[model samples]
Target: MTEQISVLEKKIEEVTKRISDLKDIDSIRNLHHTYGYYFDACLFNEVVDLYAEDSEVRFMGGIFKGKESVRRFFCDRLRMRHSNGHNGPIYGFLLDHIMMQDVITISEDGKTARGRYRTFMQAGRHELAEGLTRQWWEGGVYENTYVNEDGLWKFKILDYRGLWHADFNTGWAHTPPNLYPFFSDTYPNDPIGPDEILDIVPKPVLWPDTGVLPFHYPHPVTGDEWDQNKDLNTSK
Candidate 1:
């Protein structure tokens, strides 16, 4: 009878741990998805609040280190450019970032987690806007890390690799190279630039050049890294 009770207790403990891990995964997913909604509405300050104080951002070959620097990139730079320094969506601008396909992995201790998500973005200025009226389709990948702050999870590292972009009318097949230029200048000097410029090898390209953004995790079943040379091609 005592042996049976011990077995049952062990089984209960195992179940509890599994439940905890699943909760962590869900929390992390919700955190990221919330960020997407905030970003889509151009809530720059709110987006920055989702990050840890020591968090960093890697975007378009530029490394914006620390929460303050990330603030400069998103709040100061992006807000001015997109919404004319407004906190919410503007009348003539449309920037919708749809984040999905999250593969989240929680640490054994549950203090940290890693996730990979894909973002499909549609951004442009409407004819009512004061700027050039153009619409575009953009796809990117986010290989990010999260840290559990007390009980809440926050972004520790946000590394977004914009793979390809195309004009709404032209599409990917007719897209030109370097549609969106990477940061060539650093911060302080450029006012709204990144803290550091990463020298990426095999430099990332745009459509019609199909460059595969490397995956953060290995294959779940096979446990093998993706082949970078597998079927990717460049435009003529």
Candidate 2:
């Protein structure tokens, strides 16, 4: 009877481990999708909520820290480009696809986890720069780290390394007369000319400078050194 009881306990342990593993997998998967949703929707607040309050995010050749800085990076720099009327209309839809590859480790202590994923994003423009309409594609890999605190999983770091990027627009459409006035006098298209007849519109800036955070750059904008010790806390 004692042997039988021991066997039963072992079975229970195995089952518990499996359940824990599954939960960790799901959490990592959800994190990937959550990033895509907030990014595509331009929901800066929601994006900030996904990370730890003191998390770090490094992407597009730059690093940022804290939930506030992450929020500013997305909302102020990335999203701000749409505020202007030049690049394209803001009502268009964008689709992001993130393919998770593997979960490297789901810590038994429940304090940390790591994973890898690939992403592909496509933005479709219905009305951009007058009658000009097109699509843009960008793809990359994400190296992610998460931390469990207060029974919740929060992103600690996300490193995005670009793989490929290209735009579908070939400039086939000519600039429409109504849209011509919107363009600056020295617009690039003015000298380049157009191939086909279409409405012309001003180009929008897709990138902007987000405010910097300590530990993000070695030197702050004021030409002062950032906190050196903060580097040790980052995921690296």
Candidate 3:
């Protein structure tokens, strides 16, 4: 009878752990979704808040490291480009980040996780705006890492690979190659540049070019890792 009780207790502990992992997965998913919404609205301050103090962001082959550097990238550079230096939403501007198809993996310790998601973005500025009023379609993949900080989840690394871009009316088939260029210069030198320009192998490209943003998780069934030796373009 005592042996049976011990077996049952062990099973109960295993069941509790499984439940905790499932909850962690869902929380990580929600965290990324919230980031998408904040990004779409150009909520730079809020977006920065979602990241951990020691976090880093990888975008367009540039690495924005640390909280201050991340703030400069989003609050200064991106805000200036999208919202005319405003920290919040603006008039006659639309940037909707539709985040979906998320795959989240939690660590055994339950303190860290990795997630991959597809982001379909629609960005445009109405004619009322000062600069060129144009609309575009952007597809990207985010292979982000997260951490549980005192029971709150925050982004440890926000890595985004923008694969393709096309004019809203023209569509992707007629899209031009290298529509968006990667940063060639570092911060302070470029003023609104990345802290460090990464030496990404094979380089990243936009539209018209084929690329594969490597998966963060191993194959679920096969448990095989992606081979990175092949010349795989990091761009769309």
Candidate 4:
């Protein structure tokens, strides 16, 4: 009788473990999809909804807090520039892929969870700078923490550190037909010089208030000299 009782106890423990494992898997799977969908749709609001109100996001060397701040960080700060005729349209498409490595843990209280994953992203013919067109690929890992709030799971923290990135410059070297030039040639009605152009169209703001992250590595085209030239030309 004692042997039978021990066997039953062992079976119950095994079953509980399996169920817990399954739940953890499901939670991680949902998170993978959350990132993909948010980026694909450019759903800033929805993206924030996936996180806890006071969640923190640390990535690309910057740290941001709260859902509203996170939404603004991505939507307002990140800039993409494309040229017309000089290169091509300034805006292009993006593709993002995410792979889950593991759900490190689902806290015993079930109020917190943690996971690790890898991501590969491709940007097609996007605008990198004035008169420049490019494609880029980046791969990275994500370390995330989720919290349960009001019986719902939400992300409490997300950290993304890229491993490497490949830049394909001048990807759209060919000019498109019937496209307008980046600078207008039409005279008084048009921008006769850099001053007029700059007045009408301000330069893009590359970095945000969060000084945590280095906006980008100094590339030749976007170097100090280029910035000085832009300022000088516009001032004229």
- Write one digit per residue (lDDT tens) for candidate 3, span 1-236: 99999999999999999999899988898888888889888998999999999999999999999988899989888999999998788998999989999999888898999999999999999999777799999999999999999999999999999988889998999997777788899989988788898786667667688777788888889999988757564454
Q: Among these predicted structures, which one has the highest TM-score?
A: 3
Candidate 4: tens digits of C-alpha lDDT, residues 1-236:
99999999999987897797567658656865776666554554556668888887665434566676565444443322212222112345454555655435677666787776767777655465444455666566677788878866788887665554555453223323222223332222432211122221332111111111122223448564223223233221
Q: Which stretches of candidate 2 lie over 4 Å from their true place?
A: 1-7, 82-89, 93-95, 98-104, 129-134, 169-236
Q: How many residue pairs clash in each candidate?
A: 0, 11, 1, 1
Cα lDDT, model 1, residue 174: 79
Superior by TM-score: candidate 1 or candidate 2:
1
Query: Over all chains combined, what TM-score does candidate 4 have?
Result: 0.57
Q: lDDT per prediction?
A: 0.89, 0.57, 0.89, 0.53
Q: Which pairs of residues collide in model 1?
A: none
Ranking by TM-score: 3, 1, 2, 4
Listed in order, each prediction's TM-score against the native is: 0.91, 0.61, 0.93, 0.57
Q: List the residue pairs that clash in candidate 3.
A: 163-236
Error of 2 at 12 (Å): 2.4
Better candidate by lDDT, 1 or 2: 1
Candidate 3 weakest lDDT stretch, 10 residues: 227-236
Residue 137, model 3, lDDT = 91
Which whole-number lDDT from 0 to 100 does residue 132 have in model 3? Answer: 77
- Model 2 agreement with the true structure over 1-236: per-residue lDDT tens digits: 99999999999998898788778778778876777777666665567778888886665444566676676555655555542322222465454555655445677765788777767677665664433466766566777788888877789987665544556553213222232121232212333211112221212112111112222222335866654344333221
